[model samples]
Target chain A: MLQALRDTLPANRWIRLVLLAIVLGVIFTPWLFDGTRALDTAARLSIFVVLAASYDLLLGFTGVVSFAHALFFGIGAYAVAIAFDHFAPGFGVLLVAIVAGLGVSLLVAFIMGLVSLRVKTIFYAMITLAVASAATVLVSQLYHLTGGEDGLTYRIPKVLTPAFKLLDDKVFGVRVNGKLMNFYLVVFSSIVLFLIMVRIVASPFGRVLKALRENDFRAQAIGYNTLAYRTTATLLSAAFATLAGVLMALWLRYTGPESVLSLDIMIDVLLMVVIGGMGTLYGAIIGATVLMLAQSYLQGLMGNAQDVIGGVPILSELMAPDRWLLWLGLLFIASVYFFPQGVVGRFSGPAPKEATT
Target chain B: MTTRVEPIQATGGEPVKQHRAWWHRPDAQAAVLVPALALLALPLTGDFSAWLTLTLAGLAMGMMLFIMTSGFTLVFGLMDVLNFGHGAFISLGAFFGFTVLAGLESWRLVDSLWLNLLAFGLAAVAAMIACGLLSWAFERVLVRRVYGNHLMQILITMGGLIVAEQLIYVFWGGEDWPMLKPAAFQGGLQWGDLVFEKYRLLAVVLGLVLFAALMAVFKWTRLGLLIRAGVENREMVESFGYNVRRLFVLVFMAGSALAAMGGVMWGLYDEVITAHLGQSIMITVFIVAIIGGLGSIEGCFIAALMVGLLSNYVGFLAPKLALVSTIGLLVVVLMWRPQGLVPATQGGQ
Candidate 1:
């Protein structure tokens, strides 16, 4: 059955190879580079992978442009943090937190969708922007509950911290500690979440969603309740985004408005989706890796740029670490102009058909 | 054959009906609504003087917003382009206008009101010209590439905004500048228990003058006719031997200039300016634009007044929930109107 499953995989050999390499690389990252930093980066990549994929559910498959996605992500993070802070930090608490977070996300998604979906594309986008900004401000002002801009830090399950070592001795050239276990948990859940998303995208419901995105009027003409389909897609996407947010909180052991729900983060998600490729799920993975790595490494390079160049006046100013966003913005525009289909689209050649008019 | 015996009395009835319909016109009704709302609030606040002050302040705020948003609404109405980077022009205007004012410090520091006004006007014109030229290039290079695609237009323009913001940082450093009002407009006017800021009053007067000028140009100009015709049918206008594309570019430039003018006023109002002045204000600007309808200047103007008043009232009453109230207002407006308060198109958004 495993051999048959391998045989029936899509003929995209390069993509499969890339995926295999990534999974193996992440598994061995602790042994490969600096242990804690490598693990942390891998963990972050996994969280963003989930984020990018969930975003794709709306932007790529559903073709809905929403600016309030990070609101759900923030809610999930806050939920987990609040739960840990108020209740016991145990597995059961975590379970309840996940459910609660997802429930709230679903409810918010439904109401926002109902209100915003009535408008045309541009207006819908604007309304979401307004809602998102308001929610961000609310989160900050409700300092008692949300920790405001300073954010909230909490204890995870005892099993996930470095104090609780899994073994007294080293294993696989690395210490078997609670941190390692936690990293593994993050990677594992991310893989599972990714698979579930893949399954959903491959389903019949997903196909109908694609149809609606391509031409909603035509889909309506064909007797499909486009609104219902869109609302359901929105709910599902919000649920997954919240899960990603919860995972992020767990991995970081802290969550805050700036870290989890900033408009900057929303724009980063957009950059990831567009740079990767909109409709292709594999693009999400690739985009997340490229952006996260660039952000991490380029920031370091920028800080030390003056020392390396030694008084090249223009280069020194241009390479200031704080100026990363400028470069990212330029990269975003170039990608949209030169690669409307994104990197994945370019690599895969032309699409089977036009996904949007 | 019966048409030959039409009654002259029916002709008299037509004039009365037309006059009555004029009162029902959306703009006319909106004009009444603004004053009526102020009167209604007077009793609630129970301080006629304070209420009057707040209402005037709100109108001043609204007029400034209208100035900023008019160009955007007009450009979108005529061109169907969604320029998310419109806010960048606002920031540019504020910065350059400040530069001009600072350079003319000799005039700004004077006790003479006429000299101060001259300095202010020159600064405004300088900012407008700078933004107008930049907007021309923006449309030619960035906007031209993403025409007809709303999604791409939004993304690219957002990219443009970020880039512009970073460039501002590069040129002007990442520090907030504290702006000072000119010597002539520094003090307030007092009448018994009521006191009003001189600058706020000036802002109100300037905004009204600009509004009147725009109304006049639009009402009695050949260019206005072409623009209205172009918005209703771009292809038809083009077929009529007019260069509709040039008109679009002109409108975009005009919009950018107006945004800059609004920015200058806002900077003066806030008394502080930052590199992200545009980005921070964009949320409220977008809300106003949405509430005013996508492509209607008149609608945008009315919505701006309502939002400004709502924001001030809410801020006074519930400081913590100021933003919440504004967003709540947006949701309610969208739910009730859907097409906004005075949608440009009669049907089919």
Candidate 2:
């Protein structure tokens, strides 16, 4: 049966279609049963998918490993919180929050890009790290503006009408409310962003960016303004990240430093990219989905089986909490060691060998 | 290949004569006298008590800085691979040291000052060995594959750091472990009106000794000669059939050991060991290493001291300013001398 399916879906188009169907099926799985938890998991996974895709613009295509991409995401979330605090609530305010967040990220990215572009690889990572650290400290210290570690809490508008719809009270025997509405909102946003990314990657601009990555010096010699192009890409990446951050804030109905911008968030995004496959756009979505699902299932299983160990209850306690990050780390190492292509890349084979000619 | 300007020809032949000047020589009497006099007079001009405290604290912190950056510079200078996970090794050492000490306390072992010192010494050695072996394995298996690829090295080492940190959180619960300074070394030393912590003074003395020993080894040891040669021309060392891979491993291990030692000292000094220490301070160490030049020991030493002093002084003026001072220093250094304070004679690719 597997062989027949593979044979039937030999073409890339058919494969993509099938993958899309699987994703939609998973997204709409809540309809089948009381999978409220699964719906929440999907929403969280969607946020990560957007984040990982944003990172791919820099990490996969440009070959720059930024350690501070979360700064933009955090800024976006904070922007929405701050905007909601002052402005009247509406879709227009949400749009303004996103723009404001993107604006800040762009300004920061531009300065960082200009300064660190001269230093590639490790040096670039160091510079970006410094910026992120500085930003974190600055935010934490600015007690008045950032709520000083207490974080800001804002009342999200109950109606997200135009962009989303709250189905019937018991639509298909499932309660449709904030969580479900937020679920659709995130899924819709993720699909839209994914499509835009597909278009961007397929464009002539992406080809030039790929060339720049393969051999930057050669690209420059061939008359490409490497720095300008790279800077543009960085800005675009930061803008998308901020947008995802805004969505995250809306989904969670709260924004805090821990939730939005932290080293852990950066690590999660990096894991997603690596596990999914570097360079491939769809890898982001696949990586985020797989990782989140694994985490949720593993945690749930461990949590439920805590009493099964009987005599050594400490074992279960040790098994359940805080082991996820450790497992993720181990997975990252194993992935690098065994499956360097990442999950998606391993299955897909190498990206169509780029034509140097 | 395109025709490239040689600029400065590689120095190949005889060892250059060591220049000795009264004020210029690193070990000169004036070299010590000038800094000593400046430090002594610093209190008169500033808040005397605050300056004294800051100077002492700076000295203590400077030693840790020296240890951290020295490993970073040595590894980068010798291997041309930036071990981004160097901080993880430091964190591992601190956590391991704390665990051993805590275990000893629980077991009702000799709770004497001497025993504590012994425990610390044993922990340091164990951490060094463990970190060295782990670093060697990592370099051999993963780093070796990406010899010339800086981007891959950065990403891989980053992944390594995340793994190590997460493993640490798994093994040791996510609570801070308090460290006890030896009772004999806990009290402050009184000299005239100035009071200083004996432990901090001990740290400074130990750091100086280690620095001297490292310099002596670099000047006289055969392994050191190979390292210097490898730094200049890795290919040439390989061509000579000197087991270049072994040398790389040795350098990386030594670097890891140095960072671990620093971690032990930092834990003792701070009186607490947390997994986040490595991630929190790693950036500052990197800044110091870069500002000092990628692989220069003397440069790292000097840069660490300057940074320690600068950070303390700035923190005194405004605490928040301390956060950005090192980054500001890094930017200035990069803009002025992109290579660093004392760049390698042979330029980097």
Candidate 3:
């Protein structure tokens, strides 16, 4: 069946293998390690895969540099938070939050595109950066609505809460509970979203986006309404990002400015795409998994480093958990310098569709 | 590429002077725009003294912004490389300045005015030299490799920034340090009913001096001429056997030094220094840089002042809406003049 599915798809066998690995990884996560911790990582990883792919839709395919992506993501998180705050926490509330988040994000993306598309690329980036910062400040200041710096904490749907334990029997040394069901909910939705992103990028519209990315001037000359296409891509990307944000808020049971709307999150998305492979949709999954995993484990490494650096005061100081960002930052620069096209590009080379005429 | 020099007339003929409208000259228009806006805002504030104080505060803030952004504008003009990590220099300068001031704590406590000035000058000088040397290394190691690629420049510079910010943590730890002003520079001066913060007055005076000095160098000095010529046509300057590359590196160094000075001044202004100080203030610097034609020094100055004034006024009027108003200003300005208040030689492209 796997071979037949691979044969039906345009992608090579490697994609099939990766997809199989992902499926196996998701199914066996509870058995592979301490159930909650590993499952938590898997869920977070899945959410990031969706988030990163949506970012690639803009940065990779559309060639527009936006610093306001967090705005949409924040809106999604806030939508869920606000909905929970106002309405009873039920499945219906979740659906409403998702729709509201997607609707608002799409509108914002459209308006941002319409205004910024008039200027040059760098100018557009500046406008977005300015807007993002202003939005961030606005979010923090609206204390009554956003809970100010404390952020918003709200209840998840009763069915998804661990207190409603699903199974009495222990499954693979882990208690089968509502939390496990919620984990599967996030994982499965993320998979569906990821597949949708892949399908979108594989479509003809995606090809036009790649063309625009390579050289928009030529794309415009060739009769493509480049601006319209780009705006559409931005809206699509924002919708997916909003979905990811909703899933995150649902999983974490809280949403805040730092988590949802910070510039760092936007940069993290950029880094994921760049490191994974800008034009490759699959790279988003790979980049997110690698970076997220590393981030999770780096804290452990930092704790142990003080012991290893024993006598050297400076080295011990540098090895502190707070200083881990220094290494990550240096790693980011080294990766960009060494792998300009990113890890995926190194293996796949340039996608044939983006070849210059 | 063609040099449009007029041919000498055999008969002592004079070239016709084209009479154009006054506003047609961008320089004339920009010269009037900033002060005109300030004058326009006067009626909004009913109290003259309060209005004057706010305007002066804004001007002082604008001068500090200009000090930081001028170097950024210059680097962009000479080499079309956008250094997103320019804030790293600012942060490093502040940190280094902090160290120098901390060391001179005894000097700061002295009753003598000269001793206080000495402490401040030493710290500023120390910070500048440290930042200049570090920036030289930064340019040689990272910036040189990604010259023409805007995407890579942004990526690498941002990476550089992240690394620098983290390094600050490694050195200084994750704590916000308070930087005290010299005793002489701490208090406000009272003249009858009006009072002006001594540091703000100092900042305004120093900023004007720096602007004047920059203008003088660009207008009269041989090095300045070379730099201007090189910015216009690098190939032409190269053909004339001038090492334009070296000149640009020197300019980058000088720009970094200037940023260091701005950092020291900014630290004094804010009274608190953090690892992320540079990154935080970079938003305003970028706005100023963008609104002041990206590569135009004079335009940068005007834009910085305007932003400073607008921010102060808005903050006073509605603190919650200050950033919103500033963003609104940026959008309006860009919609009206896409290139900025004074368009640079390269423009936004």
Candidate 4:
């Protein structure tokens, strides 16, 4: 039966369809196992998928390596909190949050772009990194606005109840509450954003951006305003990242320094893009899924083995939630050493060779 | 030992005819006066508290900046490959140092300052070797395939950074390690009304010594000459039959070692070592190096000092505006002098 199933799904399209089905099955399997945790993981991974795709717009398409992408993400989350605090609370709050987040991100992008546009490649990367770090410090110091380290939390408003009305109350056709509603909301947003990213990448603007990446000087010589293209790409990328952040804040119902803005998030996005393969929309999703799932599973396994080791309990520490960074670092090193093409790129034929000369 | 070679004249004979002392040259004056003034004034100007605090802080921070940028600048200066993983090396160094120190502590050697120092040294060495081997592996497996390609190098090195950070989390755990000051260097020094931490003062002294030693190596050593030549023209150096690839690795290792040394000092000064330290500070170091000019060691030093002073002073004034200062400086510098504060020598590029 397994051999026949495998034979039936031999084609790439068939395999993709089967994978999609399995993903959906897993997402909805909470009904069978009465475990909503897997659904929560998928929702979190979806946020990452969106974040990674946004990063790819700059890193892959426009050839701009931004170290401050997390700032935009943080800005998005903070925007949501600020918006919810000032305006009426509800699911409708997402609209104001997104606008505020994108607005801040755009302003940041413009300022950073103006500064960094003069320096290309490594220098630009440095400037962006400094800006990101500075933003973090600024946020932490501004006690009135950011609440310092404590961060701001919103009470999950009652308005979200109507959105979950479709659940309607059973086991096979069971009633799902706010958590499940939030999960579905995130999943739907991820799909919409993913589709929009696909549209953007397939557009003429993306081609021009890619051309700029291939050769900025050549593109300039050919009468393209490379700076404008790059700046636009950067702004757009930050906008998407901020949108993801807003979603994250709403889903988690909390916003903190650690929640959205961090070097960890930046590194994670970079890993997702590279591991998924650069210059591909689907690669971001694939990378995010692989990394998040691996981390989740590995942490579980490591957590369980803590008792087996006695002296120098590296395994127990490694299993700790905070230690996920160590695993991520190791994965990054291993990937660079062995699978440079990344998982998706490995099977998607030869990597698209960079033209830097 | 004091043999003097005739100064090479610029093409204009009239300018050469002027009886100006060599000390009048801008570069010569800068080289001699900058350090002299900094050294003399740092301990003299403010009250003991201010002077000692600023000087020690500057020194400690400057050394860390040096480590961060030296390798990055060298790699970019020589091969034009922007190794994003440079910061990862610093992060690794800090963790390595932490691990060694922790191990020593567990072994009931907590009171042994010398042992702690040895652990620090060993950690630095290990970090240098690890970075060198990693670079070699990177070059052999990935970089070699993308030779002369900046974008690919950026992406691949970035991937390397992510993997490294993840591995760090897996092995070391995510919490910040408590950085223990060696017992011998734990106390504060009282010089009149000013009080300075012994550890920070030590860092300052060590950094100056290292700076002098590195400068001496560059000016007086054969290896330095080869490095300079290699930076000038790798093809010509290869034509001269020197092993350029090996030289690249050696230069890279030296740079990584410098960064690792900085990382160790940073751990001591900051009193905390975390996995994020590398990525967090990596960008600022890049900014320093870039603002200092891509390949100039002297420029890196000057830029580092400026960055340290700016960051600290900014943090002091409008604490909320601390982050803005560096980014603001970078913007102004890039706008004013896109090549950096000091342009690379014509032949160097």
Q: What does the interface RMSD come to for each candidate?
A: 1.5, 3.8, 2.7, 3.3
User: Which pairs of residues clash in candidate 3, taking residues 3 or more apart in a chain or in different chains?
Assistant: none
Q: Any runs in candidate 3 off by more than 4 Å, and if so which? A: A1-23, A349-357, B1-24, B233-241, B346-349
Every candidate's TM-score, chain A alone: 0.93, 0.86, 0.91, 0.85
List, residue by residue over B235-290, the lDDT tens digit for candidate 3: 89899999987998999999999898999999999999998899878888889988
Complex DockQ, candidate 3: 0.51
Model 2, position A86, has a per-residue lDDT of 74
Chain B, per-candidate TM-score = 0.91, 0.85, 0.92, 0.83
TM-score for each of the candidates: 0.93, 0.87, 0.92, 0.82
Would you list the clashing residue pairs of candidate 1? Answer: none
Q: Which digits, one per residue and each the tens of the lDDT, describe model 1 over residues A146-178?
A: 888898989999899999987898877788888
| Fnat: each model in turn | 0.69, 0.56, 0.67, 0.64
Write down the DockQ of candidate 4: 0.41
lDDT of 3 by residue, A118-206 (tens): 66666667778888889899989998998988899999888888987878988768777778888888999988887777777767787
Better of 1 and 3 by DockQ: 1
Candidate lDDT (C-alpha), each: 0.83, 0.76, 0.83, 0.71
Worst 10 residues of 3 chain B by lDDT: B340-349
| Candidate 2 docking classification | acceptable
| Candidate 4: C-alpha lDDT | 0.71
**Model 2's DockQ?**
0.42
